[model samples]
Target chain A: MADINAIAKQFTDFYYQTFDTNRAGLQNLYRESSMLTWEGAPIQSAAAITEKLTSLPFEKVQHKVTTLDAQPSNPAVASILVIVTGLLVVDDSPSPLQFSQAFQLIPEGSSYYVLNDIFRLNYG
Target chain B: MADINAIAKQFTDFYYQTFDTNRAGLQNLYRESSMLTWEGAPIQSAAAITEKLTSLPFEKVQHKVTTLDAQPSNPAVASILVIVTGLLVVDDSPSPLQFSQAFQLIPEGSSYYVLNDIFRLNYG
Candidate 1:
């Protein structure tokens, strides 16, 4: 049995760290087959995912994570479902946007990589 | 084939309307076997779920939905996965909290009811 909560917290911390500082480093988080549903649009592959991230309208952003939850897939699959909610400020916006993200992570060696990720902003 | 997008939008609108006005009416949204993961804790059964909802610390809440996305379970299962993100203001709070919620909706007759629901605030 894995300490899923600990892994989830660590991964989330590392994920947002990279997201806030080095968006380029996020390339290692996904693989060729990784899938991303970003704001209702689907993007796949590491190259495409990186492209999408780099193309976001906001040049600088900060993420404040509030909730982190994880659940292991039944039947003992290596993947875990992680849900995150947070506030995002883009380009020094006065009001931070609320965001929710979910990811399916597969363990590889001592670390885990995202298999499927979906992110959406809370308001229209 | 269902007009999934329309149904999703309509369901989201109705959901928030009831949430802000008549919290008691939320009971009809779930069934006996409905499951809820509220901020990381699991609550099962309609009575339990309702109890949890009514016990929320915030006396008055207003939800401003920013995103609503849905996908049907493959193999023609009657369930659809709905993901939502938004801002939630409780009482007269100055800074509204960010919230993310996901629901598994099962179609029953002409309507759909939540079978599994998970909600979490964005900040600790």
Candidate 2:
């Protein structure tokens, strides 16, 4: 029996850490078929998604995760579905903004890669 | 190739309609292995999810979808990952609350069933 909870925990920890520190490194976590939707704008493919993510205006940011939920969405494919809600502060901003994200992770060899990712800032 | 966009559009419309009108009826769209995380609380299985949903405080509510994004997460399994952001007015309240939900739908026979669902109201 695969421990999905443990995998999800590890993945999220690495994900946010990489996102906050070395965003360009995050590209390895996706594949050519991967898709990302950030703030209602869709970006396809790993390279494009990485480019868009690394192009965010702020030079530095920090993510504080509030909640993490995971489910084995497709056991046959060893796919884990994860949802996250958190607060993020960009640069020296006085306040943090709330955001939510969902990820579909599929196994690739020993590790996993994001097949689908969607992110949204809580407010308009 | 499956028309994921069309499928997602139909599913979201049906889901919001059922949620607003007959929450209990949403059970047909789920299976025994389904999992739901509602506002950070985890609920396992379909029956429990429907129960918790029907037990929500508000009697009447309306959902206005703002954005809908879907990706073919697992092509082999025909799994579609959907993310939705919307506003909901509860019990004739003048103010509408923002919400976000993610669903992983897998085909079972002719239709689909929700394997994983996570929902949160965008507020404190």
lDDT of 1 by residue, B3-90 (tens): 7667878888998998888777899999886877887897877888889888888888999987777655322445566778788989
What is the Cα root-mean-square deviation between model 2 and the actual structure? 2.4
Report clash pairs, candidate 1: A66-B122, A66-B123, A122-B66, A122-B85, A122-B86, A123-B66, A124-B66
- lDDT score at residue A99, model 2, on the 0-100 scale: 86
| Candidate 1, residue A105: how far the Cα is off, in Å | 3.7
Native contacts recovered, each model: 0.30, 0.77
Per-residue error for B111 in candidate 2, Å, reads 2.3
lDDT of 1 by residue, A30-74 (tens): 988677789889788889999999888878999998788775532
Q: List, for all models, the DockQ compared with the true complex.
A: 0.26, 0.65
lDDT of 1 at B101: 84
Q: List the residue pairs that clash in candidate 2.
A: none
Weakest 10 consecutive residues, lDDT, candidate 1 chain B?
Answer: B71-80
Docking class of 1: acceptable
DockQ of 1: 0.26
DockQ for candidate 2: 0.65
